[model samples]
Target: MPDAKPRLIVIDTDPGIDDAIGILLALASPAFSIAGMTTVAGNIGIETTTRNGGRLLAFAGREDIPVVQGGAAPLSRPGPEPLNLHGENGIGGVALPEPVRPPESLPAAAWLAEFLLDQPAGAVDIFALGPLTNIARLFIDNPDAARRIGRIIAMGGVVHEVGNVGPRSEFNLWADPEAAAVVVSSGLPLVLVPLDVTRRVRASREFAQALRVAGKPLASMVADLVESYFETKTHQESRPLHDPCVMLFALAPELFRLEDLHLVVNTGSTEEAGALTVDGNGTPVQVAIGVDGPAVLDLLARTLTAA
Candidate 1:
Protein backbone atom coordinates (compact mmCIF):
# COMPACT_ATOMS: atom_id res chain seq x y z
CA MET A 1 0.00 0.00 0.00
CA PRO A 2 1.16 3.58 -0.53
CA ASP A 3 2.41 5.48 2.51
CA ALA A 4 -0.11 7.53 4.39
CA LYS A 5 -0.10 11.25 3.64
CA PRO A 6 1.92 13.48 5.95
CA ARG A 7 -0.04 15.58 8.44
CA LEU A 8 -0.77 19.13 7.28
CA ILE A 9 0.60 21.77 9.65
CA VAL A 10 0.97 25.52 10.04
CA ILE A 11 3.68 26.93 12.33
CA ASP A 12 3.02 30.39 13.80
CA THR A 13 6.39 31.55 15.06
CA ASP A 14 8.52 34.40 16.40
CA PRO A 15 11.83 32.75 15.33
CA GLY A 16 13.38 33.17 18.73
CA ILE A 17 16.43 30.87 19.13
CA ASP A 18 14.21 28.17 20.58
CA ASP A 19 11.63 28.93 17.93
CA ALA A 20 14.33 28.59 15.26
CA ILE A 21 15.26 25.18 16.65
CA GLY A 22 11.59 24.14 16.57
CA ILE A 23 11.37 25.29 12.95
CA LEU A 24 14.44 23.21 12.21
CA LEU A 25 12.81 20.16 13.77
CA ALA A 26 9.65 20.65 11.73
CA LEU A 27 11.60 21.12 8.48
CA ALA A 28 13.60 17.94 9.02
CA SER A 29 10.70 15.71 9.99
CA PRO A 30 8.78 13.82 7.27
CA ALA A 31 5.74 12.99 9.37
CA PHE A 32 4.24 16.45 8.76
CA SER A 33 3.73 18.56 5.64
CA ILE A 34 4.34 22.17 6.54
CA ALA A 35 1.63 24.17 4.79
CA GLY A 36 3.19 27.54 5.67
CA MET A 37 5.17 29.51 8.26
CA THR A 38 3.47 32.57 9.75
CA THR A 39 5.67 35.12 11.49
CA VAL A 40 4.61 37.23 14.50
CA ALA A 41 6.30 39.75 16.80
CA GLY A 42 7.28 38.24 20.17
CA ASN A 43 10.96 37.68 20.84
CA ILE A 44 11.71 40.79 18.80
CA GLY A 45 10.28 42.96 16.03
CA ILE A 46 7.98 41.63 13.34
CA GLU A 47 10.43 42.40 10.51
CA THR A 48 13.24 40.38 12.02
CA THR A 49 11.00 37.41 12.78
CA THR A 50 9.76 37.37 9.19
CA ARG A 51 13.33 37.52 7.88
CA ASN A 52 14.37 34.74 10.19
CA GLY A 53 11.68 32.52 8.67
CA GLY A 54 13.16 33.04 5.19
CA ARG A 55 16.70 32.45 6.47
CA LEU A 56 15.67 29.22 8.22
CA LEU A 57 13.91 27.91 5.11
CA ALA A 58 17.02 28.60 3.07
CA PHE A 59 19.14 26.72 5.56
CA ALA A 60 16.80 23.73 5.49
CA GLY A 61 16.09 23.69 1.72
CA ARG A 62 12.40 24.33 2.36
CA GLU A 63 12.00 27.70 0.64
CA ASP A 64 9.11 26.25 -1.33
CA ILE A 65 7.06 26.57 1.85
CA PRO A 66 5.51 30.03 2.15
CA VAL A 67 6.62 32.45 4.86
CA VAL A 68 3.80 34.92 5.43
CA GLN A 69 4.15 38.00 7.61
CA GLY A 70 1.68 38.31 10.48
CA GLY A 71 0.79 40.76 13.30
CA ALA A 72 3.31 43.52 14.09
CA ALA A 73 2.06 43.94 17.65
CA PRO A 74 -0.31 42.20 20.01
CA LEU A 75 -4.08 42.59 19.93
CA SER A 76 -3.71 45.34 22.59
CA ARG A 77 -1.41 46.51 25.42
CA PRO A 78 1.69 46.90 23.27
CA GLY A 79 4.94 46.94 25.25
CA PRO A 80 8.69 46.41 24.84
CA GLU A 81 10.36 43.10 25.55
CA PRO A 82 12.86 42.92 28.40
CA LEU A 83 15.95 44.90 27.32
CA ASN A 84 18.22 43.00 24.87
CA LEU A 85 15.96 39.96 25.50
CA HIS A 86 16.79 38.02 22.33
CA GLY A 87 19.71 40.19 21.17
CA GLU A 88 19.73 42.90 18.49
CA ASN A 89 18.24 40.97 15.54
CA GLY A 90 16.66 38.05 17.40
CA ILE A 91 18.08 34.54 17.11
CA GLY A 92 20.88 35.81 19.36
CA GLY A 93 22.63 37.90 16.70
CA VAL A 94 23.43 34.87 14.55
CA ALA A 95 24.59 35.73 11.02
CA LEU A 96 22.63 34.39 8.07
CA PRO A 97 22.58 35.65 4.53
CA GLU A 98 19.50 37.46 3.32
CA PRO A 99 17.00 35.13 1.65
CA VAL A 100 16.52 35.68 -2.06
CA ARG A 101 12.82 34.80 -1.96
CA PRO A 102 10.33 37.22 -0.44
CA PRO A 103 7.54 36.30 1.97
CA GLU A 104 4.11 35.63 0.50
CA SER A 105 2.31 38.87 -0.34
CA LEU A 106 -0.93 38.23 1.55
CA PRO A 107 -1.04 39.06 5.22
CA ALA A 108 -0.77 36.08 7.61
CA ALA A 109 -4.38 35.92 8.84
CA ALA A 110 -5.89 36.25 5.38
CA TRP A 111 -3.42 33.81 3.89
CA LEU A 112 -4.16 31.32 6.65
CA ALA A 113 -7.92 31.63 6.14
CA GLU A 114 -7.63 31.09 2.39
CA PHE A 115 -5.41 28.08 2.91
CA LEU A 116 -7.72 26.54 5.53
CA LEU A 117 -10.84 26.91 3.42
CA ASP A 118 -9.09 25.00 0.65
CA GLN A 119 -8.45 22.06 3.01
CA PRO A 120 -10.98 19.88 4.76
CA ALA A 121 -12.15 21.19 8.10
CA GLY A 122 -10.03 19.88 11.00
CA ALA A 123 -7.15 18.72 8.78
CA VAL A 124 -4.55 21.28 9.78
CA ASP A 125 -2.71 21.35 13.10
CA ILE A 126 -1.33 24.73 14.17
CA PHE A 127 1.94 24.84 16.12
CA ALA A 128 1.87 28.17 17.90
CA LEU A 129 5.46 29.04 18.89
CA GLY A 130 4.82 32.65 19.69
CA PRO A 131 2.04 34.90 20.96
CA LEU A 132 -1.55 34.30 19.79
CA THR A 133 -1.88 37.63 17.95
CA ASN A 134 -2.11 36.05 14.51
CA ILE A 135 -4.32 33.21 15.63
CA ALA A 136 -6.60 35.66 17.40
CA ARG A 137 -6.69 37.77 14.24
CA LEU A 138 -7.75 34.74 12.23
CA PHE A 139 -10.68 34.37 14.58
CA ILE A 140 -11.58 38.04 14.42
CA ASP A 141 -11.38 38.37 10.61
CA ASN A 142 -12.48 34.88 9.65
CA PRO A 143 -14.42 33.02 12.28
CA ASP A 144 -15.45 30.47 9.68
CA ALA A 145 -11.84 29.55 8.97
CA ALA A 146 -10.98 29.50 12.67
CA ARG A 147 -13.49 26.68 13.18
CA ARG A 148 -11.59 24.59 10.63
CA ILE A 149 -8.46 24.30 12.75
CA GLY A 150 -7.80 20.78 14.06
CA ARG A 151 -5.89 21.95 17.09
CA ILE A 152 -3.71 24.80 18.31
CA ILE A 153 -0.76 23.40 20.25
CA ALA A 154 0.72 26.51 21.81
CA MET A 155 3.78 27.21 23.98
CA GLY A 156 2.55 29.73 26.52
CA GLY A 157 1.46 30.31 30.13
CA VAL A 158 2.96 29.13 33.41
CA VAL A 159 0.96 27.17 35.97
CA HIS A 160 3.11 27.00 39.09
CA GLU A 161 6.36 28.47 37.84
CA VAL A 162 7.20 32.14 38.18
CA GLY A 163 6.34 34.23 35.14
CA ASN A 164 9.12 35.04 32.73
CA VAL A 165 7.86 38.58 32.33
CA GLY A 166 6.24 39.82 35.55
CA PRO A 167 4.98 38.27 38.79
CA ARG A 168 2.05 36.48 37.17
CA SER A 169 2.56 36.33 33.40
CA GLU A 170 4.56 34.42 30.80
CA PHE A 171 5.94 36.38 27.88
CA ASN A 172 3.80 35.00 25.08
CA LEU A 173 0.49 35.32 26.93
CA TRP A 174 1.69 38.48 28.67
CA ALA A 175 2.53 40.01 25.31
CA ASP A 176 -1.18 39.80 24.51
CA PRO A 177 -3.55 38.55 27.13
CA GLU A 178 -6.45 39.64 25.00
CA ALA A 179 -5.34 37.32 22.21
CA ALA A 180 -4.86 34.47 24.62
CA ALA A 181 -8.31 35.10 26.01
CA VAL A 182 -9.80 34.93 22.52
CA VAL A 183 -8.16 31.65 21.58
CA VAL A 184 -8.83 29.95 24.90
CA SER A 185 -12.53 30.79 24.77
CA SER A 186 -12.93 29.91 21.08
CA GLY A 187 -13.85 26.36 22.25
CA LEU A 188 -11.42 24.76 19.82
CA PRO A 189 -9.12 21.84 20.60
CA LEU A 190 -6.31 23.60 22.45
CA VAL A 191 -3.23 22.14 24.11
CA LEU A 192 -1.02 24.46 26.15
CA VAL A 193 2.65 23.64 26.78
CA PRO A 194 3.18 25.96 29.69
CA LEU A 195 6.50 26.89 31.32
CA ASP A 196 5.98 24.44 34.18
CA VAL A 197 6.75 21.67 31.68
CA THR A 198 9.03 23.51 29.22
CA ARG A 199 11.59 24.39 31.89
CA ARG A 200 12.44 20.70 32.07
CA VAL A 201 13.70 20.46 28.48
CA ARG A 202 17.09 22.06 28.98
CA ALA A 203 19.93 22.06 26.47
CA SER A 204 22.51 20.00 28.23
CA ARG A 205 26.19 20.20 27.31
CA GLU A 206 25.79 16.78 25.74
CA PHE A 207 22.90 17.91 23.57
CA ALA A 208 24.89 20.90 22.38
CA GLN A 209 27.81 18.54 21.66
CA ALA A 210 25.57 16.38 19.48
CA LEU A 211 24.62 19.37 17.34
CA ARG A 212 28.24 20.43 16.95
CA VAL A 213 29.31 16.95 15.87
CA ALA A 214 26.60 16.65 13.23
CA GLY A 215 28.93 18.20 10.64
CA LYS A 216 26.21 20.33 9.06
CA PRO A 217 26.07 24.09 8.81
CA LEU A 218 22.54 24.38 10.19
CA ALA A 219 23.28 22.07 13.09
CA SER A 220 26.55 23.89 13.84
CA MET A 221 24.86 27.26 13.97
CA VAL A 222 22.21 25.90 16.29
CA ALA A 223 24.94 24.49 18.49
CA ASP A 224 26.57 27.88 18.82
CA LEU A 225 23.22 29.46 19.64
CA VAL A 226 22.67 26.90 22.38
CA GLU A 227 26.06 27.60 23.91
CA SER A 228 25.55 31.34 23.77
CA TYR A 229 22.26 30.93 25.62
CA PHE A 230 24.08 29.66 28.66
CA GLU A 231 26.64 32.51 28.69
CA THR A 232 24.40 34.84 30.65
CA LYS A 233 23.02 32.25 33.01
CA THR A 234 26.51 31.92 34.58
CA HIS A 235 25.04 29.92 37.44
CA GLN A 236 23.10 27.34 35.43
CA GLU A 237 24.57 24.53 33.33
CA SER A 238 21.75 24.54 30.78
CA ARG A 239 18.93 26.76 29.61
CA PRO A 240 15.37 25.59 29.18
CA LEU A 241 14.64 25.03 25.51
CA HIS A 242 11.18 26.63 25.33
CA ASP A 243 9.40 26.61 21.97
CA PRO A 244 11.13 23.47 20.76
CA CYS A 245 9.24 21.59 23.47
CA VAL A 246 6.03 22.35 21.60
CA MET A 247 7.31 20.53 18.51
CA LEU A 248 8.64 17.67 20.55
CA PHE A 249 5.24 17.11 22.11
CA ALA A 250 3.65 17.24 18.68
CA LEU A 251 5.91 14.48 17.39
CA ALA A 252 5.68 12.31 20.50
CA PRO A 253 2.53 12.89 22.46
CA GLU A 254 2.90 9.46 24.01
CA LEU A 255 5.96 10.74 25.82
CA PHE A 256 3.98 13.42 27.59
CA ARG A 257 1.25 13.46 30.20
CA LEU A 258 -1.36 16.20 30.17
CA GLU A 259 -4.09 17.39 32.53
CA ASP A 260 -7.45 18.95 31.84
CA LEU A 261 -7.60 22.30 33.56
CA HIS A 262 -9.67 25.47 33.59
CA LEU A 263 -7.69 28.68 33.13
CA VAL A 264 -8.57 32.34 33.63
CA VAL A 265 -6.55 34.81 31.55
CA ASN A 266 -6.53 38.30 33.05
CA THR A 267 -7.22 40.96 30.40
CA GLY A 268 -7.84 43.95 32.64
CA SER A 269 -5.81 47.19 32.81
CA THR A 270 -3.82 46.42 35.94
CA GLU A 271 -0.25 45.06 36.05
CA GLU A 272 -1.69 41.54 36.37
CA ALA A 273 -3.69 41.88 33.17
CA GLY A 274 -1.79 39.19 31.31
CA ALA A 275 -1.68 36.78 34.22
CA LEU A 276 -3.01 33.23 33.79
CA THR A 277 -4.72 31.56 36.74
CA VAL A 278 -6.73 28.45 37.48
CA ASP A 279 -10.35 28.53 38.55
CA GLY A 280 -13.25 26.15 38.31
CA ASN A 281 -15.22 28.50 36.08
CA GLY A 282 -12.41 29.29 33.61
CA THR A 283 -11.89 27.83 30.13
CA PRO A 284 -11.14 24.12 30.04
CA VAL A 285 -7.94 23.18 28.24
CA GLN A 286 -5.29 20.46 28.21
CA VAL A 287 -2.10 21.52 29.91
CA ALA A 288 1.08 19.44 29.65
CA ILE A 289 2.35 18.34 33.05
CA GLY A 290 4.96 15.70 32.38
CA VAL A 291 7.44 14.64 29.69
CA ASP A 292 10.10 12.01 29.15
CA GLY A 293 13.08 14.34 28.96
CA PRO A 294 15.70 11.88 27.69
CA ALA A 295 13.46 10.58 24.95
CA VAL A 296 12.67 14.10 23.75
CA LEU A 297 16.34 15.02 23.73
CA ASP A 298 17.09 11.92 21.70
CA LEU A 299 14.39 12.77 19.20
CA LEU A 300 15.72 16.29 18.82
CA ALA A 301 19.24 15.07 18.17
CA ARG A 302 18.27 12.36 15.70
CA THR A 303 15.75 14.39 13.71
CA LEU A 304 17.97 17.47 13.40
CA THR A 305 20.97 15.43 12.20
CA ALA A 306 19.04 12.79 10.30
CA ALA A 307 20.12 11.90 6.75
Candidate 2:
Protein backbone atom coordinates (compact mmCIF):
# COMPACT_ATOMS: atom_id res chain seq x y z
CA MET A 1 0.00 0.00 0.00
CA PRO A 2 1.11 3.60 -0.55
CA ASP A 3 2.03 5.72 2.43
CA ALA A 4 -0.51 8.06 4.01
CA LYS A 5 -0.65 11.51 2.42
CA PRO A 6 -0.56 14.96 3.95
CA ARG A 7 -3.89 16.47 4.89
CA LEU A 8 -3.80 20.30 4.75
CA ILE A 9 -2.68 22.72 2.00
CA VAL A 10 -3.60 26.15 0.68
CA ILE A 11 -2.98 27.25 -2.92
CA ASP A 12 -2.39 30.93 -3.63
CA THR A 13 -2.62 31.48 -7.38
CA ASP A 14 -3.68 33.79 -10.17
CA PRO A 15 -5.53 31.42 -12.51
CA GLY A 16 -3.22 31.48 -15.53
CA ILE A 17 -3.62 28.64 -18.07
CA ASP A 18 -0.82 26.74 -16.37
CA ASP A 19 -2.29 27.67 -13.01
CA ALA A 20 -5.44 25.76 -13.96
CA ILE A 21 -3.34 22.68 -14.61
CA GLY A 22 -1.63 23.16 -11.25
CA ILE A 23 -4.98 23.36 -9.47
CA LEU A 24 -6.26 20.24 -11.18
CA LEU A 25 -3.02 18.46 -10.30
CA ALA A 26 -3.50 19.28 -6.63
CA LEU A 27 -7.17 18.28 -6.57
CA ALA A 28 -6.43 15.02 -8.35
CA SER A 29 -3.38 14.02 -6.33
CA PRO A 30 -4.17 11.96 -3.24
CA ALA A 31 -1.03 13.32 -1.58
CA PHE A 32 -2.82 16.53 -0.65
CA SER A 33 -6.17 17.50 0.81
CA ILE A 34 -6.70 21.09 -0.32
CA ALA A 35 -7.83 23.34 2.51
CA GLY A 36 -8.82 26.19 0.19
CA MET A 37 -7.71 28.30 -2.78
CA THR A 38 -6.83 31.98 -2.62
CA THR A 39 -6.55 34.12 -5.74
CA VAL A 40 -4.16 37.02 -6.25
CA ALA A 41 -3.73 39.50 -9.11
CA GLY A 42 -0.99 38.24 -11.35
CA ASN A 43 -2.50 36.86 -14.53
CA ILE A 44 -5.44 39.24 -14.36
CA GLY A 45 -7.31 41.47 -11.96
CA ILE A 46 -8.29 40.09 -8.57
CA GLU A 47 -11.97 39.69 -9.47
CA THR A 48 -11.32 37.82 -12.69
CA THR A 49 -8.63 35.63 -11.16
CA THR A 50 -10.82 34.70 -8.20
CA ARG A 51 -13.77 33.94 -10.44
CA ASN A 52 -11.57 31.82 -12.71
CA GLY A 53 -10.27 29.91 -9.69
CA GLY A 54 -13.81 29.22 -8.56
CA ARG A 55 -14.71 28.11 -12.06
CA LEU A 56 -11.89 25.54 -12.12
CA LEU A 57 -13.03 24.08 -8.81
CA ALA A 58 -16.60 24.01 -10.02
CA PHE A 59 -15.53 22.28 -13.23
CA ALA A 60 -13.58 19.71 -11.25
CA GLY A 61 -16.70 19.01 -9.18
CA ARG A 62 -14.96 20.46 -6.11
CA GLU A 63 -17.14 23.37 -5.09
CA ASP A 64 -16.47 22.42 -1.50
CA ILE A 65 -13.08 24.18 -1.69
CA PRO A 66 -13.78 27.80 -0.93
CA VAL A 67 -12.15 30.47 -3.08
CA VAL A 68 -11.14 33.92 -1.81
CA GLN A 69 -9.98 37.03 -3.66
CA GLY A 70 -6.86 38.79 -2.47
CA GLY A 71 -4.50 41.67 -3.27
CA ALA A 72 -5.22 43.58 -6.45
CA ALA A 73 -1.71 45.03 -6.75
CA PRO A 74 1.78 44.36 -5.57
CA LEU A 75 3.09 45.81 -2.31
CA SER A 76 5.42 48.14 -4.24
CA ARG A 77 4.79 48.34 -7.97
CA PRO A 78 1.62 49.54 -9.69
CA GLY A 79 -0.41 46.52 -10.80
CA PRO A 80 0.70 45.15 -14.15
CA GLU A 81 -1.76 45.03 -16.99
CA PRO A 82 -2.95 41.49 -17.77
CA LEU A 83 -0.82 39.46 -20.16
CA ASN A 84 -2.25 37.96 -23.36
CA LEU A 85 -0.54 34.63 -22.69
CA HIS A 86 -3.58 33.30 -20.84
CA GLY A 87 -6.07 35.25 -22.93
CA GLU A 88 -7.99 38.30 -21.70
CA ASN A 89 -10.13 36.26 -19.30
CA GLY A 90 -7.33 33.92 -18.32
CA ILE A 91 -7.91 30.13 -18.35
CA GLY A 92 -6.84 29.66 -21.99
CA GLY A 93 -9.66 31.71 -23.58
CA VAL A 94 -11.98 28.80 -22.86
CA ALA A 95 -14.85 30.10 -20.82
CA LEU A 96 -16.99 27.69 -18.92
CA PRO A 97 -20.41 28.57 -17.55
CA GLU A 98 -20.28 31.30 -14.91
CA PRO A 99 -19.41 29.82 -11.55
CA VAL A 100 -22.41 29.36 -9.33
CA ARG A 101 -20.41 29.22 -6.13
CA PRO A 102 -19.68 32.54 -4.49
CA PRO A 103 -16.22 33.16 -3.07
CA GLU A 104 -15.59 32.85 0.68
CA SER A 105 -16.46 35.84 2.85
CA LEU A 106 -12.88 36.68 3.83
CA PRO A 107 -10.20 38.12 1.60
CA ALA A 108 -7.48 35.74 0.40
CA ALA A 109 -4.71 37.02 2.68
CA ALA A 110 -6.84 36.76 5.78
CA TRP A 111 -8.18 33.34 4.88
CA LEU A 112 -4.67 32.11 4.20
CA ALA A 113 -3.37 33.43 7.50
CA GLU A 114 -6.26 32.11 9.59
CA PHE A 115 -6.28 28.76 7.83
CA LEU A 116 -2.56 28.25 8.38
CA LEU A 117 -2.94 29.12 12.05
CA ASP A 118 -5.77 26.64 12.45
CA GLN A 119 -3.68 23.78 11.13
CA PRO A 120 -1.12 21.91 13.18
CA ALA A 121 2.50 23.05 13.00
CA GLY A 122 4.27 21.90 9.85
CA ALA A 123 1.03 20.46 8.51
CA VAL A 124 0.18 22.98 5.82
CA ASP A 125 2.22 23.41 2.63
CA ILE A 126 1.66 26.60 0.66
CA PHE A 127 1.96 26.37 -3.11
CA ALA A 128 2.18 29.90 -4.50
CA LEU A 129 1.92 30.23 -8.30
CA GLY A 130 1.50 33.96 -8.68
CA PRO A 131 2.68 37.23 -7.23
CA LEU A 132 3.60 36.78 -3.56
CA THR A 133 1.66 39.88 -2.52
CA ASN A 134 -1.05 37.97 -0.71
CA ILE A 135 1.40 35.66 0.99
CA ALA A 136 3.57 38.59 2.08
CA ARG A 137 0.58 40.39 3.53
CA LEU A 138 -0.38 37.27 5.43
CA PHE A 139 3.08 37.14 6.95
CA ILE A 140 2.95 40.79 7.91
CA ASP A 141 -0.46 40.36 9.54
CA ASN A 142 0.24 37.01 11.20
CA PRO A 143 3.89 36.18 11.43
CA ASP A 144 3.30 33.20 13.68
CA ALA A 145 0.84 31.59 11.32
CA ALA A 146 3.21 32.13 8.38
CA ARG A 147 5.95 30.46 10.37
CA ARG A 148 3.79 27.45 11.03
CA ILE A 149 3.72 26.33 7.43
CA GLY A 150 5.74 23.20 6.64
CA ARG A 151 7.19 24.83 3.53
CA ILE A 152 6.42 27.15 0.64
CA ILE A 153 6.96 25.90 -2.92
CA ALA A 154 6.79 28.79 -5.35
CA MET A 155 6.97 29.20 -9.17
CA GLY A 156 8.70 32.47 -9.92
CA GLY A 157 12.16 33.99 -10.51
CA VAL A 158 14.74 33.47 -13.29
CA VAL A 159 17.92 32.54 -11.51
CA HIS A 160 19.92 31.42 -14.54
CA GLU A 161 18.01 32.66 -17.57
CA VAL A 162 16.99 35.93 -19.17
CA GLY A 163 13.73 37.22 -17.73
CA ASN A 164 10.55 36.68 -19.69
CA VAL A 165 9.07 40.05 -18.69
CA GLY A 166 12.28 42.07 -18.87
CA PRO A 167 16.04 41.69 -19.04
CA ARG A 168 16.13 40.15 -15.55
CA SER A 169 12.71 39.22 -14.19
CA GLU A 170 10.08 36.59 -14.79
CA PHE A 171 6.44 37.67 -15.07
CA ASN A 172 5.24 36.59 -11.63
CA LEU A 173 8.16 38.07 -9.65
CA TRP A 174 8.13 41.11 -11.90
CA ALA A 175 4.45 41.58 -11.13
CA ASP A 176 5.29 42.03 -7.46
CA PRO A 177 8.97 42.37 -6.59
CA GLU A 178 8.38 43.74 -3.11
CA ALA A 179 6.10 40.86 -2.24
CA ALA A 180 8.68 38.44 -3.59
CA ALA A 181 11.36 39.99 -1.39
CA VAL A 182 9.24 39.72 1.72
CA VAL A 183 8.33 36.06 1.24
CA VAL A 184 11.90 35.04 0.40
CA SER A 185 13.20 36.83 3.47
CA SER A 186 10.42 35.54 5.74
CA GLY A 187 12.72 32.82 7.16
CA LEU A 188 10.44 29.95 6.24
CA PRO A 189 11.61 26.83 4.46
CA LEU A 190 11.14 27.67 0.79
CA VAL A 191 11.67 25.70 -2.40
CA LEU A 192 11.85 27.90 -5.49
CA VAL A 193 11.07 26.51 -8.97
CA PRO A 194 12.50 29.36 -11.00
CA LEU A 195 12.31 29.85 -14.77
CA ASP A 196 15.83 28.49 -14.96
CA VAL A 197 14.52 24.95 -14.52
CA THR A 198 11.04 25.43 -15.93
CA ARG A 199 12.45 26.84 -19.17
CA ARG A 200 14.41 23.65 -19.61
CA VAL A 201 11.22 21.63 -19.38
CA ARG A 202 8.53 21.85 -22.03
CA ALA A 203 5.32 20.09 -23.00
CA SER A 204 6.26 18.76 -26.41
CA ARG A 205 3.99 18.20 -29.40
CA GLU A 206 3.76 14.53 -28.57
CA PHE A 207 2.57 15.26 -25.03
CA ALA A 208 -0.08 17.66 -26.26
CA GLN A 209 -1.21 15.05 -28.79
CA ALA A 210 -1.51 12.53 -26.00
CA LEU A 211 -3.58 14.92 -23.88
CA ARG A 212 -5.85 15.61 -26.82
CA VAL A 213 -6.29 11.89 -27.36
CA ALA A 214 -7.52 11.59 -23.75
CA GLY A 215 -10.85 12.96 -25.07
CA LYS A 216 -11.60 14.76 -21.81
CA PRO A 217 -12.85 18.30 -22.29
CA LEU A 218 -10.47 19.84 -19.73
CA ALA A 219 -7.46 18.03 -21.11
CA SER A 220 -8.40 18.99 -24.63
CA MET A 221 -8.78 22.61 -23.57
CA VAL A 222 -5.33 22.61 -22.00
CA ALA A 223 -3.80 21.00 -25.05
CA ASP A 224 -5.29 23.61 -27.31
CA LEU A 225 -4.01 26.43 -25.10
CA VAL A 226 -0.53 24.97 -25.19
CA GLU A 227 -0.68 24.85 -28.94
CA SER A 228 -1.92 28.41 -29.26
CA TYR A 229 0.55 29.80 -26.75
CA PHE A 230 3.49 28.18 -28.47
CA GLU A 231 2.50 29.25 -31.95
CA THR A 232 2.15 32.90 -30.97
CA LYS A 233 5.48 33.20 -29.18
CA THR A 234 8.78 33.45 -31.04
CA HIS A 235 10.92 30.30 -31.28
CA GLN A 236 8.53 28.60 -28.89
CA GLU A 237 7.27 25.27 -30.14
CA SER A 238 6.01 24.17 -26.71
CA ARG A 239 4.72 25.74 -23.53
CA PRO A 240 6.44 25.31 -20.21
CA LEU A 241 4.26 23.70 -17.60
CA HIS A 242 5.51 26.33 -15.14
CA ASP A 243 3.21 26.35 -12.13
CA PRO A 244 2.81 22.57 -12.07
CA CYS A 245 6.53 22.25 -11.41
CA VAL A 246 6.11 23.83 -8.00
CA MET A 247 3.41 21.34 -7.03
CA LEU A 248 5.52 18.56 -8.50
CA PHE A 249 8.40 19.53 -6.23
CA ALA A 250 6.14 19.32 -3.21
CA LEU A 251 4.43 16.09 -4.23
CA ALA A 252 7.56 14.45 -5.63
CA PRO A 253 10.74 16.17 -4.45
CA GLU A 254 12.89 13.23 -5.44
CA LEU A 255 12.36 14.17 -9.07
CA PHE A 256 14.39 17.37 -8.68
CA ARG A 257 17.84 18.64 -7.70
CA LEU A 258 17.77 21.41 -5.14
CA GLU A 259 20.43 23.89 -4.02
CA ASP A 260 20.46 26.40 -1.20
CA LEU A 261 21.01 30.03 -2.23
CA HIS A 262 20.24 33.62 -1.25
CA LEU A 263 17.72 35.19 -3.62
CA VAL A 264 17.02 38.93 -3.78
CA VAL A 265 14.43 40.72 -5.91
CA ASN A 266 15.28 43.80 -7.95
CA THR A 267 12.51 46.36 -7.90
CA GLY A 268 14.50 49.31 -9.21
CA SER A 269 16.03 50.07 -12.62
CA THR A 270 13.80 49.81 -15.68
CA GLU A 271 16.26 47.50 -17.44
CA GLU A 272 16.43 44.74 -14.84
CA ALA A 273 13.36 45.45 -12.80
CA GLY A 274 11.83 42.50 -10.94
CA ALA A 275 14.92 40.35 -11.42
CA LEU A 276 15.57 37.77 -8.72
CA THR A 277 19.28 38.24 -7.86
CA VAL A 278 20.60 35.23 -6.04
CA ASP A 279 23.66 35.60 -3.81
CA GLY A 280 25.23 32.37 -2.66
CA ASN A 281 25.77 33.88 0.78
CA GLY A 282 23.51 34.66 3.75
CA THR A 283 20.41 32.63 4.65
CA PRO A 284 19.94 30.07 1.88
CA VAL A 285 16.66 28.88 0.41
CA GLN A 286 16.23 25.82 -1.78
CA VAL A 287 16.14 26.40 -5.56
CA ALA A 288 15.46 23.70 -8.13
CA ILE A 289 18.15 23.42 -10.81
CA GLY A 290 16.94 20.34 -12.71
CA VAL A 291 14.14 17.83 -13.01
CA ASP A 292 13.07 14.65 -14.78
CA GLY A 293 11.05 16.47 -17.43
CA PRO A 294 9.67 13.48 -19.34
CA ALA A 295 8.66 11.74 -16.15
CA VAL A 296 6.99 14.91 -14.86
CA LEU A 297 4.98 15.23 -18.07
CA ASP A 298 3.85 11.64 -17.71
CA LEU A 299 2.93 12.23 -14.08
CA LEU A 300 0.89 15.30 -14.99
CA ALA A 301 -0.95 13.46 -17.75
CA ARG A 302 -1.82 10.47 -15.55
CA THR A 303 -2.87 12.58 -12.57
CA LEU A 304 -5.22 14.70 -14.64
CA THR A 305 -6.83 11.53 -16.03
CA ALA A 306 -6.81 9.50 -12.80
CA ALA A 307 -10.26 8.61 -11.57
Name model 2 segments beyond 4 Å from true. Answer: 216-218, 228-235
Off by over 4 Å in 1: 1-4
CA-lDDT, candidates in order:
0.87, 0.83
In model 1, the worst 10-residue window by lDDT is 77-86
Q: In terms of TM-score, how similar is model 2 to the real structure? A: 0.94
Report the lDDT tens digits of candidate 2 across residue range 1-307: 9789665788999998888878877887888899889899988899999999888888778888888888988886689989887887887677566676899899887887788777788999889999999889988888888899898999998888788988778988889887888888888888889998887668877777888898876676567656656655757667788998987788778878898888777778485766877776545789998888877777878876663
1-307: candidate 1 lDDT, tens digit per residue: 9877788999999988899888888877777899999999988888989999998888777779999999998887775563365677788777776765899999999999999999999999999999899999999999999999999999999888788877788889888889999998888899999888888888976778888899876677778778767766667788888898888998899988999999989998776767888999998999998888878888888877873
User: Which candidate leads in lDDT?
Assistant: 1
Candidate 2 has its poorest 10 consecutive residues by lDDT at: 225-234
- How displaced is residue 132 in candidate 2, in Å? 0.2
